[model samples]
Target: MKKYKLLWLCTVLVCLTLVFVGYRAKAQTFNSDLPFLIHTAESLNGKVTEWTLFTRETVHLASNKSWNQKTKSLHKQFPNMAWTYVKNRDSKTYTGISRKNNYVETIKLLSTNVNGKSYSFLIYEVSGKHWNDHKVENLNKMVSSQLDKLYDKKPVIFSCIQGHFSDKIDNVLLYEKNRLLKSLQAKKVEALEENDFYSVSAYSSKLSQELSTKKKEEMNVQIGLRKSGLGANTNFVIGTPIITIEY
Candidate 1:
């Protein structure tokens, strides 16, 4: 009996030590590198979810080397997340999928030349089901906190909309470099010339339809879509608005 008791006690201590070591290792792995901010949003159908994190510094590494390093790190941190690797001529991609909730994370490294200089750009994105909003929010917060270590200044643009067509003219609030430029109300006639940022009177389910040939030829613009109606399932009908923000 005494011998059995001693063996059991020794086994318990070893198990506790291993658990503590693993916890510390996980903590260390997630502590060093993190994203600046995580953008989380749900799809129109709410069937799919998306999270994107942009890093301040661009990654400069050989295509193969970068792919291998990222794959190793992601696999280590998310041991349960199965990973698939693919290599193309100018880009390497690694995608990880969580077994628990079918969450997916993709890391891509693309080789490009800027001003005759070769560069590697890294993009990290994740998507999953929108069933648990709190879980998604918490995950983003934790990931961003880790990425805050590599925080650097970068310009970002954002916009918001207000007012209903029936009550008043719909207004768009635009921000650039974290400063509000102006609030634009829906106009009777869309401007022929493009400004730094502008809103158009166009409404379309397809983003490509909003831009005109002249506008595309003259200026560079990024487009965003905002949909409002009876609900996400409501089809195109009366009072349905699909606002496009071109910046």
Candidate 2:
């Protein structure tokens, strides 16, 4: 009886130890320091010259800073700005506007906390009647620079709604990812199919097809490093390719 009890206890301890180690290894595979979405945003940013910063948000942080405090910090960086706030049943939006060289730049900040992580969205809306590719590139670069300065350590995921249907954009994104993986000296990179989430509805079908067709010529490859062990890497699509980065 004593021997049987000792064997059962030993087996339980070994199982628990294996479970804990597996969890830790899985956690390490994800680039917790920089979310996959941020990497995708950066990749897309490099591909487009006239993309708008539709939204930027963060999740799963250790900070306890209030939304007001965070917004105030951002405001200090951009002096001579006017802000307006609107409250809805679910969320609040604080919008800041500034004009430079006849171009109106608007930054809308939306704040909410879910579970324990603070979520904030910085929406950059640039106004110009004639927004050529050159102008668009400059605007995106300027906004991205400002964002980088504000959230140096935080991982920001961005969405671009303007150039979602362009085949050129898709090609550039794939090229960049391939180039990046090669630069990283990754042993192998594999393309992932669009998830069912993007294939369910008609609207999603259109967007997913445009962004992630299996056709080799038009393929929106979401390359993943095979050695990363991140488990079936998936493409991020929100009417466009959102996050496609490997740790």
Candidate 3:
């Protein structure tokens, strides 16, 4: 009886392990390569209910508490929420709160000078904002707003509506920033590899600042995006769109 019970227990353990592995495989779409941020979001939905990507230290994208408050405000303020999975380490789950509630505001601390002048960046803390902030609302009105006050032409906007982020926009916000720089004519851009200390934007500003110290200088505008763990070695099979704009 004891030997038979042992055999039954072993069989049950093997079956249970197979079930667990099967469940996880079904939960997160197992793609050998991650395509784009858009593709990742679509593949992860209704899979594992919710799973945090491998814990990468959150970089506190927003500098202050107000930014967190804004995220919360947008969460509450928006009527409809859009679901998206972001690629951080593996992938993170994101929900689009309404535009009124989802506006994001962050400050880029400038390292040095730009175009012969000290370059510093700061924006007012939006305590309560919404997803609508991401909307392609009045590009006309914002043409006069600070968002583009300094630019000559709107840097090739890839905007959709404000309430929810389409696969297109998710790839833009979380991915395209770097790829765009390599394409811009007015500036010298460099595509930095992972673990590089500075983003392309930061690098551009710092370069301009260094140039200011030397002699004549130009403002080198650089768009930047960082990569995550969803690369070729992972289970990021397909259906996810990772937006990689040609630079």
lDDT of 1 by residue, 130-202 (tens): 3344464566565455344222322111111221112111332122111111111122223221222233332
Clashes of each: 3, 0, 28
lDDT at position 149, candidate 2: 63
lDDT of each: 0.32, 0.38, 0.26
Q: Which candidate is the best by TM-score?
A: 2
The best candidate by lDDT is 2
Query: Which digits, one per residue and each the tens of the lDDT, describe model 3 over residues 1-247?
Result: 3543343344334322322232111112112111122223333231111111010111233333644454454345433544232434322233442233334322121222346433222221111212222333432243225334223332211111101112223334334333333222224322333341122322232111111211233222222232222231111111101111111
| CA RMSD of each candidate after superposition | 21.5, 16.9, 21.0
lDDT agreement of model 2 with the native: 0.38
User: Over the full model, what C-alpha lDDT does candidate 1 score relative to the true structure?
Assistant: 0.32
The TM-scores of all predictions, comma-separated, are: 0.37, 0.38, 0.23
Expressed as tens digits, the lDDT of each residue in 62-132 for candidate 2 is: 34356677678658877677988887655677788887773677777776656755566665554432234
- Stretches of model 2 off by over 4 angstroms after superposition: 1-51, 59-65, 100-103, 113-118, 125-127, 133-137, 153-247
Colliding pairs, model 1: 34-146, 34-147, 35-147
Name the runs in model 3 displaced over 4 angstroms. Answer: 1-122, 125-179, 189-198, 201-215, 230-247
Ranking under TM-score, best-scoring first?
A: 2, 1, 3
